[model samples]
Target: MSILVFVEQRDARVRSIVREVLGEASRLAAVLGGPVVGVCPAASDPGLATLGDAGAERVLLAAHEAFARYDAAGYTLAVVAAIEAVKPQVVLFGASAMGRDLAPRVAARLGVGLATDCTALAADGGRLTATRPVFAGKAIQKLAFPRVPALASLRPKVFAPAAASGRTATVEPLTVGFDPAAARAKVVRMAAAAGARVDLTEADVIVSGGRGLQDAGNFRLIEELAEALGAAVGASRAVVDAGWRPHSEQVGQTGKTVSPKLYVAVGISGAIQHLAGMSSSRCIVAINKDPEAPIFKVADYGVVGRFEEVVPALIEAVKQLNAQV
Candidate 1:
């Protein structure tokens, strides 16, 4: 009943979401009377050792020339091979761009059920229970899977990383066969957006503006507040479509999903599509002149006022808070 966690690498380092997945996998594995194992592609990835420290009993390195760049087919093959070798009872992956595309393929190949964008996972009475939002974040549904090697792709930041275990794992290198060129889609190049402050999914704090901002330059106020709190600046689809912000900075069903510790929504009316993406955030703060804005329905705190007046005050408050800290 061992658990297998797919650890992701970004810029040769482990992505922050990997640690959260480790914590979740460890808890589930402990309950199932199995050890948690971490799997990652090997190619001078500095994240392997860190995965072990996060609580994996062993770190399985899948090193092959094909894995240097992410070939969904190649990675799928490698994960399938690793699962066959380890015989894990449950598999976990962060529901990121890679995981969303990769996990389903592996699950389909294995002929197993897979839960995507799961907010919570648990092993109860010898079955895996997956909890996720449904009906556009208006409700939550819990499902149980009976098949062995249950697969799940978890939402980032929903689970917190546990304290470091300091346990060194037996690193096993996996050997598999796959052709990168055979993949239908090949990653040729990656271009980082200039002056992007945060990776939306990984940000602990997010300050987002919406149609209420009225214009793009108004986003600078959101950025200033984010900077003061060491947070990330985000925008709703309306703002992005209006060219008030970059699409990469948009957080909604049509864009990137995020579950930050603290989420500040400015001028957003809380459309269902927008809520679907960030409803899982730990704390939600809404600032809109319209008290009737739908966002306040789910907001933990609400400041009903015009953004031009409210945002500056919030920024000043955050600056003072930082000074005190």
Candidate 2:
């Protein structure tokens, strides 16, 4: 009947994945000629009302004390309840950590098929289909859903956030009768590092460094350039393993997979493991002293030079470009 979008929030803030999912939902809704309904779990968050700007005609909010913090059981049940009510032909979620954890539970509860980490969606022949990378992004597979209420989780940044429509959304209260005793895992407290980082998975642009940086001190090169470019700082697994950077900043098979619009690799001799994580990035620029590095094979732009010599110049150049803007 409608396209149901799961709105994910954290620390009282709406996550970018939610907006990204909404943008895709808007596109899908256009194809299906259906209205977009957003389902949010929480008490009245002021931010939850903004989904209308992203294409929601109406929002169903389940505001309750049990939803103040995430309880896997409580949240899952709330979503299932919303799904049962909406009875939509398609559902959309961002392929975020929360979405990955929750989408499966909802799909199982509804006895529906789900496609995870989808990079693309198509309205083909009056039906929706999804495409995802397989074999660690080395291959692509298109999926067709044979049932109504088919679920799909989108990879962040694959679609631009929809422009705000400047219309106020009608918010309705959703009822979630959650029982705390059913939840085994509970969030007690949350702490952040002194400096909050732009998560690699969510960042639109990333500047990552590797072992060729020589030591932790040289990481300033990556940081400075990232600052100039308004990009997140990422690190190769080698740099993280060597204690040159935090594990949270690591990007590779063992770390976070990112598909940012722009990815800059500095001194990272690209290993297959690392490529698998970021190969889907829209634009990749690799800088290395060794031109023969495997990273050059996949990089859209390659620079053969010492990062120390090149990064400062690049940072200055970016500053100049920004000043012009």
Question: How many backbone clashes does every candidate have?
Answer: 0, 2
* Model 1 lDDT per residue over 161-255, tens place: 86798877778888778766567888776776423556888789999999998878888898899999899989999988987788989887778
Model 1 TM-score relative to the real fold: 0.92
lDDT of 1: 0.85
lDDT scores of the candidates, listed in order? 0.85, 0.87
Colliding pairs, model 2: 42-63, 43-63
